[model samples]
Target: METRQEAVTGTIGCATAVLGAFAGIAVWFPYGRTALFGAFEGETNPTDLWLGLPVLALGGAATAVAVLTAVQGRRRIAVGLAAATAALAAFGYAFDVLAAPQALQDCGSPC
Candidate 1:
């Protein structure tokens, strides 16, 4: 017998986690080589794809867990997933901001 507040909170947390995961994935994967070229005007590295795939998978799992917890009305679990999503999102952003530029730099012109 969960309270309405708990249910609402759980739903909100799940939504937050889902959105965060999507954002993290976007930053991690970008849009293949074309998108990378449009943004940074350089050759994209295969190594980046290797590194980002695992992060995207982990974020996807976190989002799924959040959704499941919300559906089950598990407020605490939903909240924990939401917090993990936030941390992952932050880490993804930091990795993109710091690592992306260096990788692009390595591409040189016409990358």
Candidate 2:
């Protein structure tokens, strides 16, 4: 039987690893660009406000559930679920096509 401490540690470790992957994807993925080219399409990246944030939120929820289960004495299952949660975040926008660096040109700043 696993102790509360051990289970919690495992869950956190897995969750943290997922979050690390999330950070890497965010830094490298294009957050701003034209989703489609057209005269009135304007410039906007729907992936940001739509896709990325939601998956992160879902992962957070899964992490929360994992912690909850860990405290209940189901460490192994909790760890697996927590890892799955984190993976869900990566599924969001992490694998999208990379756009030209100049398209958005540093979204938060002037390109």
Query: What does candidate 2's lDDT look like per residue over 6-58, in tens digits?
Result: 89877876676567556544644444334433112255455454555455555
Give the candidate number with the greatest lDDT.
Answer: 1
Q: In model 2, how large is the Cα lDDT of residue 11?
A: 85
Worst 10 residues of 2 by lDDT: 32-41
Query: Model 1 reaches what TM-score against the true structure?
Result: 0.50
Candidate 1 residues lying further than 4 Å off, grouped into runs, are: 1-30, 33-42, 97-111
| lDDT per residue (tens digit) for residues 1-111 in model 1 | 999998997787667667756765665555444334444545454544655655665677687777677787889988998788778668666665325545455666767
The list of candidate 2 runs beyond 4 A from truth reads: 1-42, 96-111
Worst 10 residues of 1 by lDDT: 30-39
Error of 1 at 63 (Å): 1.0
Question: Candidate 1: lDDT over CA atoms?
Answer: 0.63
Q: What is the C-alpha RMSD of each candidate to the true structure, in Å?
A: 7.0, 9.1
